[model samples]
Target chain A: MAGSLLIELDRVEKTYVQAGVDTRVLRGVSLAVGRGEFVALQGPSGSGKSTLLHILGLLERPTAGRYLLSGEDVSGFADDRLSELRNRHFGFVFQSFYLIPYASALENVLLPGLYGPESRRSLEHRAQELLARVGLADRASFKPSQLSGGQQQRVAIARALINQPAVIFADEPTGQLDSATSAEIMQLLADICTQGASIVMVTHDEETAAFAQRRIRILDGRILDNGGPGPAEG
Target chain B: MRRALRLLPRVAGFALDAVLAYRLRSAFVILAVALGIAALTVIVTSIDGANRKALEIVDMFGHDAVFLLGGDIESRAVGKRTLTLTWDDARTIRQSIPGAYLAVPMRAKSNITARFGSRNFDLPVVVGTTEGYAQVWNWPLSEGRDFTAEDVAHGAKVGLIGDTVAQELFGDRSPVGQIVFLGSLPVQIVGRLSYRGLSGGGGSVDDRIAIPLTTLAQRFNLDRKYFRAIRVKFHNPEFMDAHVENLRSLLRHLHRIAPDQPDDFTILTADQILQFLAMLRGGLVAFLGLTAGGAILVGGFVLANLFSISVAERTTEIGLRKALGAATWAITAQILAEAAMLTLAGALLGMALGMGLGQALSRLGILEIQFSMKVFAIAVASALAIAAIFGLRPARHAAGLDPVQALRRSEG
Candidate 1:
C-alpha cells in the first residue's frame, strides 16, 4: 500500500449453520485497501465475493479472522461499538439504491447524519451540498419512486458520504443502470475516491471493475490475486 | 444517549411517514383503539356523574335526617305506593325517641297535573305534608310564608309551590296568594319554595306542589290512618345511629310486629344512600369495565398483528437504515414511536366521540355522563400503555433483523 491503510483483512473466514449442517461461505482471505484507494472485487456468482464485501462493510462478522480498519483490529468489537464505528467511519452503496421510498432525495441523503453527532442545520446543509455534488440538487425534493434508477443511485451515493466515512463499500452500485449511467456512476465513485475517501466495490462486470485503480479476484471464498496498483483503464 | 436524542425528530418524522404510507393498516388499529378509549371515557364520565348526584342528594337530604318510607326497601316495586306508615307513626316517633326532635309525615304522587287559569303543567310532584315539614326538611319558603299550625289543624286547603311550578303556571308573577288546582281541588298558594336543581334520579326537584296533609287526605279520599313516608330530624347528628335504633324499635313496638317479622317500613339515612349508590356504581363499573377491556384487548391485538406485518413489509427499509448506521435501539424507537402516535390519535378521536355520545344521552334524558380533564388523561394514559405492551414484540423483531440477510432477502 502506498498510502495509510484504511481496511485490512487477515485470513478472514465465515461459516453459516442451518438445520444441523455447517456451510462454509468464506475461506482464508487476505486483502488491504489504503486511504483514497479505489479497489474492485471481481468474481462469479457464489464465489463468496458478496460475503467478503459484507464482512468488510461490518454488516456481518467473520466467523474466524482478524479484520482491521485503519490498522486497528475490530473483530472483537461489540455490536453497538461496531454500529458506532459503522456510522462514524464506514458508508455503503447497494445495487438497488435502497433509498427510503417515503423520504425525498434530500431526506435520504440526510439519513446517516441523523445517527451521527452532527447538528440538524449543518447536516441539512451538507445534504443539500452533496445532492448538488451528485447533480441531483434540483431533484432533492423528489421521492425514490418519482426519480429514475440512476438518480436514485446518486441519492444513495450522496447518503453514503453524509457521515464522511473512511471507506465506501459499494456492491454492484451500477447493476440496475444502463451502460452509460453505469459509467457515469463509476466515474462519480472514482471522483469521490480521489477526494480522499477509500472505495471497495464488488462487481462481476469487467468493464465496471476496469474503472478502479486495482482489481482483486475472488473464487471459492479465497482471493486469487490482489492486482498491482495502476491507472484505471478507460 | 445524546445521539439518540438528536435523532429523535428525524426518527419521529420517519415513523410518521410510515404510518401515513400504510393508511388502511393504520386506520384499522386506530379505529380499534378509538372504540376502546371511547368506552373507557363513557364509563369514567358516568361514574363521575353518579358520584356528583350522590353528593347532591346528601346535601339536600341533610346529614342529621332519616327517611322512613312506607314500603319495604328490598321488595318495593315501582309505581305501587305502600301505605304502611301513617301520621300517627310520625307523632309517635317524635314523642318516643329521646334525640329525635322533629318528624314530618308526607304523601306524594308524581305526574300530577297542577293548573293555574288555563295553563297546566304535568309531571309536577304533589306532596301532602304538615306545617313543620319545611323546618324539618331544612327548606324555607323563598317568596311567601309557610303554612301555620292552624292550616294543619283546620285541614285548610293551602299549598306551597316550588320554583318550577311558579315559573310554569305563573310565569314571572309571584305565585303567593294565587289559587291553583291540584287535580280537581283548588288551593291558594301560601308560599313559593326555593329552587332545587336536579334530583338523584335526574328529575327536576323544583317541579313540586306541597299541600296540607289533612286537606290532601280529605279531598283525595285517601286513608287518613296511613301515609307514605316520614322525615325524621335528630337533635344531634353525632348520635344518629343510636337515634335510628331507638326509632326503629319504637316503630316496631307501635306496629305490634314480632321479633321474627321483617319491618314493613324502611329507614334510609345519608350513609345508606351512599352505600346504595356505591352498589349501583360497582355493577356499572364491572359491566362497563368488561366492555372497555374487550375493546382494548381486540385493539391491542390488531395493533400488534398490524405492526408485525408492517415490520415484515419494511424489512428492506430496516436493513437500509441499519446499513445507514441506525442502531438496534434506533430502529426499535422508530417503530415504537409509530405505535405511540397512532394510539394518541385514536385516544383523541375516542374522547371526542365519547363526549358527543355522552352529551346526546344527557340531553335526551337517557343517561347523565360527566366529562372532565381527568377522564381525558386516563383515556390517553391507557391508550399509551396499550401501545407499549403490544408494540414491543414487532419493534424487537425489526431491531433484531440482520442487515445483510434483510437486504439479501429483499434482493431475492
Candidate 2:
C-alpha cells in the first residue's frame, strides 16, 4: 500500500472549564500521520495524551484550530458528518477493550458496521472475517465476559478494523494486558500496519512504544520529542 | 428492497435481545404496563356494551313510540299521582293526530299469583287494548295467537302468557288453550309469547301476562275514564319530535293548564333513552381514559427510572460506541427503541389479558364486555408515546457523554 498523509492537525487547542476556571489541556498542538504508518504517542498520566488522541480520532472537536482528515477540512463539520467520516475513514481501540458485555465477541466486533446501511449478512460476514484474522475464529459466539482480557482486546482490535478504515487510533491498546499478551497484540497491530492500515497508539510504557516505527513523547500538552532513536536502550 | 424489509425482523430481534438482557427487571416493567392496559380495556368495553344493550331495549319497545307518565316535572315527588290517563285519551290522540299510527291504553299490576294444578308463581299482569296492541308494541308471538278485535268486542275471558310466565305455570306442558287462574278469574290461556330475554338490566321481560283491555276493565270493575297510561306510536319514526310537540299542545288544552304551569303528564321517547345512554357512555369512556392515562404516567415514571439507571450502568459503553463512530442520534435512537419495544410488548400482553378478563366477567353475569379495534389501537399508541416522552432525557444524557471522562471513570 502507498504511504500518504491521512490526518493533519494545525494549532489545535482544547480547554477544560470547571467552576468558572479554564485549564488548557492541548496548547497549539500540531501533528500529522501518514497512511500505513505505525506511530506511538508516549506520555505520563495527566499529560493530555488521551485528549490529543480523542481529537485525532474525531471523538472530540478542538476548542481552536483546524483538523483535516484525508484532505477534507473537518473543523466545522456537524456531529453527524464527523461520525460518518470517522466510521468510513477511521477505527478505534481502547485499553479496556470496551466490548459491550451483553454482546458476543462477534457482536462486539460487528458494532461499528451496525450504524451503516450494510445488510446484516454482509456485516456478519465482515465481522467473522475480522475475528478470524485476529485468531478468534472459534470464539465468535462467546460473550465478552467469557473471553480473557487479551481475547477481549483482540476482539476490540477486530472491531476497529471491521470498517476497513484507513487509520486506527488505539488509546493504550495493551495497557491492561500481560507482557506476553501485550507483545502478541503489538505484533498483531504491526502486522495490520504492514497490511496497509495506519495505526496511532498512545502508551506510557517505553517497551510498548518500542514496537512502533516512529515515537513521539508529549509533556504538558506539548511535543517534547519526535522520531527519537527508539526506546532509550530498553 | 425486499431484503431491507426482511431486516426489520432482525432489528426487532435486537430490540428483544436488549429487553431480555435484564430478565427480571424487564418482566416487572412489562407486567405493570399490562395490568394498566387490561383494566382500561375491560372498563371501556363493558361500559360501551352496556350502553348498546340499553339502546336495544328502547328499540324493542317500538319505533316512534312515546310514553305518557304522570309526574311533577319541577320537583322530585314521592308516591304515584292520582291523575290517570284514560282510554278515551288514547281514542282522542288517535283521532286528533293524523301522524299517529296506533294508540293503545295500558294498565299494569305487579306480583299477581297464578295457580295451575297447585303450582303457583307471582307474575306481572299487563292489561291493554285488543286492536293494534301487538302492532304498537311489536311483540312477537312464539306460539298460538294474539288477541283480535273480536276478543275486545265480546269482552272475552282470554289471556296471553309470556315465556317466563308459561315456564313457571306449566313447565314443559303446552300452555295453549289451558285454563290458568289469575286472581280467581279462571281466564283461558289463548297463546304463549316469545322470550325477549333481559332488557339491559338483566330482568326478564318474559315474566308477564297480557289480557284484553275490555276484559280487564270488566273483570276488575275499572272505569274506562280511569285507565293507567296511553302509549302512542307514530306513523313515521322521523316525525317523533313533531308528534311529541303536538301531544304536548293537545294535553295542555285538554287538561285546562295555564301557559306558566308545567304539564302534569311526561312524554318519554326512545330518543330520550338514547340520549341518556349516550351521556352515560361518554362519562364512562372519559373515566376509563383518565385511568389509563394515569397508568401510563406511572409507566413513564418507571421507564425514566430504568433509563437513568441504564445510563449510569452503560456510561463506558456509551463512550465506546461514540468512539466507534456512533452519532448522538444513533445512540438516542437505540435507547428510545428499547423503551418503545418494552412498552409495545406490555400493551399487547395487556390487551390479551384484558379481553380474557372481560369475557370471563361477562360470563359470570357481571358487566357486558365487548372488544373494539379503536380501543386497542389507542392503548398501543399511548404506550409507545409514553415510552418516547419519558425516555428522551436519559437518551440525551447517554449521548452527551465525554469519551475521555467515561473511559477514565470506568477504569477508576
Candidate 3:
C-alpha cells in the first residue's frame, strides 16, 4: 500500500435507539486508509463492521465525532453534499448485489455517471470497459435477473468503478456467492487495488479477509487495538 | 441541476420500468384515472354538441324573427282554447310598428289526413297561412312556386307541401301538378318546401303543409276573423329586446288587459329559446361536472395512495439511487414526472373510449355528440393536474427518506 493518507476518522460513534432502548453500534472507533491500499474489516455478527463501512462511505453520519476525507473534516456535512462526495469520492458494493433488477447490467453500471456533476456521454465507453475488466462485457445487455449471483456481483463492481471513485466500500461482496465464484470476486478485488484504487472491505470470513494486504478486527462495536484502525497495517 | 438534468432519462426510465413491473397495481390506478376522464370527455362533448345544435337552430330560426302565439308556450299553464287575437291584430301590428317588421298570421291544425289519388298519408300538421309565410319562415322551395297574393285574396285551393309530404304523396315523382285533398277539400300542390331536419321550436318543419289562408278559412269555416299565431320579423335584430317590450305593451293595450295580469298571448323568439337552451345545458354540465369532479377526487386519492405504496415498496431502489448521487429534488421530479405520464396515458385512452360511447349515444338520437377542441384540452389538462397535484405529497415522502434507514429496511 502507498503512504499518503486519504481517509481519517477520529473517535466516531453510532447509536441506535429502539422503543426507548439505546444500542451503541460503533463506539469511539477511529480508522484511516491510505491511497491505493487494500484493507478488510473483520468482525462477528453485530460487531458494527458494516456500520463502520457505512460511515466511512458517507452513506451515514456518525452520531458523534469527526471524519475527514483527504484531511478535510466532513463529519457534519449536509446530506446532499455528503451524497455528492459519495458519488465522486467513494463507491459501495452491498452483499445483496442491489443492481436494479429491471435495468440491464450496462445500464446499472452507467448509474453513477448518470447522476454525477457533468455529461455522461463519455461514461458509456468507460462503463463498457469496466464491465469488460470485470469479465462481464458480453453480458452487458442482460438484466440483473438474467445474471447469476457471481455475474451480478461483478456488475456491481463494474458499477462501483464507473466514476473512478477514490475508495471502494464493499460490504460482504462475495457473501452470496459459492466458494469458486467467491475466489474469483476476491481476485477481481485484488486486481482493482493494484489499479491504484483504495478498498475497505467488511467480511466475517478470514479467507475473504486474506485477499486484503492489511486487516483490522472489531468486536462488540469497539476496536481491539489503537482504540481504532489506522492507515498503517492493523 | 445539470447533474439532475443528465439523470432525467434514467429517472424516467426507472419510473416507467416500475409501472410495467407492477402491472396489476399500475393498471388499477390507470383504470381509476381513465374512468374519470372518460366520463368528463363524454359529458363535456355532449354538452358542447348540444350547444352547437342549439346554435344551428338559431341559424335556422333566423336571429331577427319572433313568434307571437295565441297559446301558452312561455310557461306550463295552458288551455288549448281558441284565442281572441285576430287577423286584424296582425294587420295592426304590421302597419303600426315602424321597425320594418313583417307580421304573417298563421292558423294550424295537426294530424290531418291528405289523399292524392288512391294514396293517403297522415299529415303531421296543416298550416293556414298567407302569401308571405315562406319568406317569413325563411323556408325555400325545392320545386315549383310559392302561392302569390292573388291566390290568398281569391281563396284559391293551392297547397305548398314540404319535401317529406311530397315524398309520401307522389313517391319519386314531383308533386307540383298534383291535387291533394285535405278532408273533403281538394287542393293543387303549388310548390315543395326544402327539407329542414329539425326546427328550433320543436318538431320537423318539413313534415307539414302550407295553404292559402282564405282557402282554409272559407273551407274549414275556421273563423276568418282569428289567427292562431303571428310570425314577426324585424329588419334589425339588435333592437330585439326593446321591440319585445314594445310589442308586449301594444298587445296588452289592444287586449285591454290590466298591468298585473299575465299577458293573454305568449311571445317566442330565437334568442329566448337559445338562452333557455343554454341555461338548461349549463345546469346539466354543472351537475355532470360535479359528479365527474367527485370521480376525479376519488381517483386522484387512489392514485396518490398507490404511489405512496409504490414509494414504500421501492424504498431500497430509492436508497440505491440516492447512494449513487440522486438528490431529493431528483427523486421528487422522477415520481412527479411518472405521475404525469400515467395520468396522461389514462386521459388519452379515456378520450378514445369516450368517443365510442358518445357516438353510441348519438346513434340512439339522444343528442348529436361532437368533440370540441377546446373541451378536449380542458379534459386532458384537468386529469393530468389532479394526478400531479395529488402525487406531490407521496413524492415528498419518498424524497425525505433517510438513505441508510431505507437501505436497512430493504435489506431486512
Candidate 4:
C-alpha cells in the first residue's frame, strides 16, 4: 500500500448463502501486488484460491472489507463500473481455454478490443503480432476446435495480452496441457511478465508456481507461507 | 453511435446465421407465425369490406335520409289497435321543414306475385313516388329510363324492375320494354336496375320491383290518406339530430300528443343504420382480435421455447462473451435483436401471403379485399411486441449467467 500498489485487499471477507445456510469462503484476507509483480498463488482445492482470484478480478464483491484497484476503492462500485474496470485493467486465461468456438483464432484473440476504441485494422494487426509472438501466426484463421490443445492454450495466452492489461489473471492456464505444453505456456506467461506487465496465476502445480517471482500458499482460506520455492525450475 | 450502428447489422447477421443453422426448425416457426397473421388479416379485411358494402347500400337511399314508420307492429298487435301515418303528414313535413329536401310517400305491399310469359315469382313490391324517387334515393338505372313526372301525373302503367326480378322473369332475354303482369295488371318494364348485392344485413334490395305511387294508390285500392310511411331526405347529414328534434316537435304539435307520451311514429335515419353496421363490424373485429391475440400468444410461447433452447445451447458462448469484456447490456441486446429479427421476418412474409390470399379470394368473387395500411401497421407492431414480450425471460436468463458455472458446464 506504500509504493503505488496496483491491487490491495484490506481484510476482505466473502460469505455465500445457499439453502438458507451461510458458508464462509474467505476470512479476513489481506494482500497486495505492486506494479509489474508476478505473484503466483498455490493451494489445495476448496482453499478459497479461486474465490480470492475472483474477488481480485472484480468478478465478485467481498461481503466485508475494502478492495482497491490502482488506488481507487472499488468494493462498492456498480456492476457496470466493475465490468469496465475488469475490461480496461485485467485479462483472464481459464483452465478450459474459453475461446468462442465459432470465431477464428484471430477473431478470438481480437475479441477483447471490440469493446474499446481500438480501430479494427490496428486490433487485427495487434492480434497477428501477438499470435506470431506465441508462434501461432499461421493458425490465426483456424477455429479453436481445429487447433490442438496446446495451440488453443497459446491462442488464449495471446488473447489475454490483446488489451495490454496492467495484469493478467491466469487460473490454471496449463491445467489442460501436457508437461511440455505446460512448460511452453509458462515460458510464454513469464515472457509477458518480462514485458513490464504483472501476472497473478493461481495453480496447484508447484512446478508451474515456481516460474513466478513470488509464490504464496493458502490453506483453509488463509495464507500459510510466502517467499517459498515452487516446483517449476527457475 | 456509428460503432453501435455498425454492430447492429453484425448482430443481426449473427442472428440470421444462427437461425439458418437450424433451417427446418426455424422455417416451421416462421410458417406458424405467418399463418396466424394471414388468418387475422383475412378476417379483419373481409369484415371491413362487408361494413363498407352495407354503408353503400344505405347511401343508395340518399344522404341524411330518414324513414318515418307508424306505431311499432308488436305494440299495435298486442294492444289490438291500428295506428298509421298519412300522406297529409308527409306533405306537412316536406313543406314545414327548412332542411328537408324530398318528402316522398311510400306504400309497400308484401307477397306480390308477378308474371312474365309462363314464369311466375313472389317478391316484395314497393309502390313509391315517381317524380322524386330516383333523384332522392340515388338509384342508378342499369338499363332503360326511370319514371318521369309525366308517368306519375298520368298514372302510366310503366315499371322499373330490379336485376333479380329481370333475371327470374326474362332469363337471358332483355326485359326492357317487355310487359310483366303485376297483380292482374300488365305493367310495361321501362327499365332494369343494377344489382345492389347483399349488404351486411343479409338482405338484397335487388329482389324488389318499383312502381309509381299514384298508380298503386288508385288501382290497388291502398290507403291514400294514410300512406304506409314517409321517406324524407335531408340536405345535410351532420344536422340530423337537430332535424330529428324539429321533426319530433312538429309531429307532436300536429298529432296533439301529450308531452310525456311516447312518439307514435319513430324516425329511422341512415345514422342509425350506420351505427348498427359499425357495431356489427366492431364485434366481428373484436372476434378476429381475440383469435389474433391467441395466435400471438401461441407464437410468443413458440418464441420463448426457441430462445430458451438457444440460451441453453449457447451457455458457453455467453460465458466467452462475458470473459471478452462484453457488458450485460450488450449481451442482452444481442438476444433481443435476434428475437425481433425473427418476428419481423415472419411478419413481412405473413403480410405477403395474406395479400396474396386476399387477391385470390377477390378473384373468386367472394369479397372485395382491401389492404388497409392500418392493418399492416398493427400486424408489424404486434409481431415486434410479441417478440419482446416472449424474448425477455430467456434473454435475461442468458445475460444473468454466472461466467464460472457457464464455462464449467460447457467443459463438462
| Fnat by candidate, in order | 0.70, 0.57, 0.63, 0.30
Report the lDDT tens digits of candidate 3 across residue range B1-412. Answer: 6666667887787778777777877788878888788888888888888788888778777878888888565553655544657877887788777583688888887778999888887876889998878888898888888888899889999999988778888999999978999988899998999888774333567778889888888988788887788888887889988888877888888888897777878888897879988998888788878877887788799889999998898898888989877788888988887787778777887787878888998877765688878757977797779767889998998888988888889878
lDDT of 1 by residue, B1-412 (tens): 7767878888898899889988998899899899999888888998898888888878788999999988687877786457888767888888888988888889876777988899998855688888777787778778888878799888998998988889999999999999998888899998998887775453687888888888888888888889989999998899989988998898888888899977878999999998998999899899989998998899899999999999999999998888778888889999999999999999999888888888987788755798899998998898899899999999999999999999999999
**Poorest stretch of ten by lDDT in candidate 3 chain A:** A225-234
Q: Rank the candidates by TM-score, best first.
A: 1, 3, 2, 4
Whole-model alpha-carbon lDDT for candidate 2? 0.80
Over 4 Å off, model 2? A1-3, A228-234, B1-13, B79-83, B112-131, B149-157, B164-174, B179-187, B213-227, B364-366
Give the least accurate 10-residue stretch of model 2 chain A, judged by summed lDDT: A225-234
CAPRI quality of model 2: acceptable
* TM-score for chain B considered on its own, for each of the candidates: 0.94, 0.85, 0.88, 0.80
**What digit string (tens of lDDT, one per residue) describes model 4 on residues A1-234?**
545588888888889899999988888888887778899888999998998888888878899988888777989987756766777788999988987776789988887777655677888899999999999989999989999998999999888888899989999999999999999999999999999888999999989998999987777877777554322211
> Model 2, A29: alpha-carbon shift in Å?
1.2
The TM-scores of all predictions, comma-separated, are 0.96, 0.90, 0.91, 0.77
Off by over 4 Å in 3: A1-3, A117-120, A226-234, B71-84, B112-123, B163-175, B180-187, B195-203, B213-225
Candidate 1 C-alpha lDDT tens digits along A163-220 = 9989999999989999999999999999999999999999999999998998988888
Q: Name the 10 consecutive residues with the lowest summed lDDT in model 1 chain B.
A: B196-205
Evaluate all candidate structures by whole-model CA lDDT and list the values in order: 0.88, 0.80, 0.84, 0.79
Per residue, candidate 4 scores C-alpha lDDT tens digits across B1-412 of 6656655555565566566655655766676677667766777677768666776867775557887777654345466323467767777898998799788777776678989889997876656565676656677788888888798778788888888989999988889999988879788988888887753322357777778877877778876666667788888778989888888888878878898876777787777767777787788678867887777778788888988988898898887777667677767777887787778778878878877888898677666578898668877887788778888888899888877678768878
Supply the TM-score of chain A against the true chain A for every candidate structure: 0.95, 0.94, 0.94, 0.95
**Candidate 2 residue lDDT tens string, B249-270:** 9877877779997777788788
Candidate with maximal DockQ: 1
Interface RMSD of each: 1.2, 3.3, 1.7, 2.7
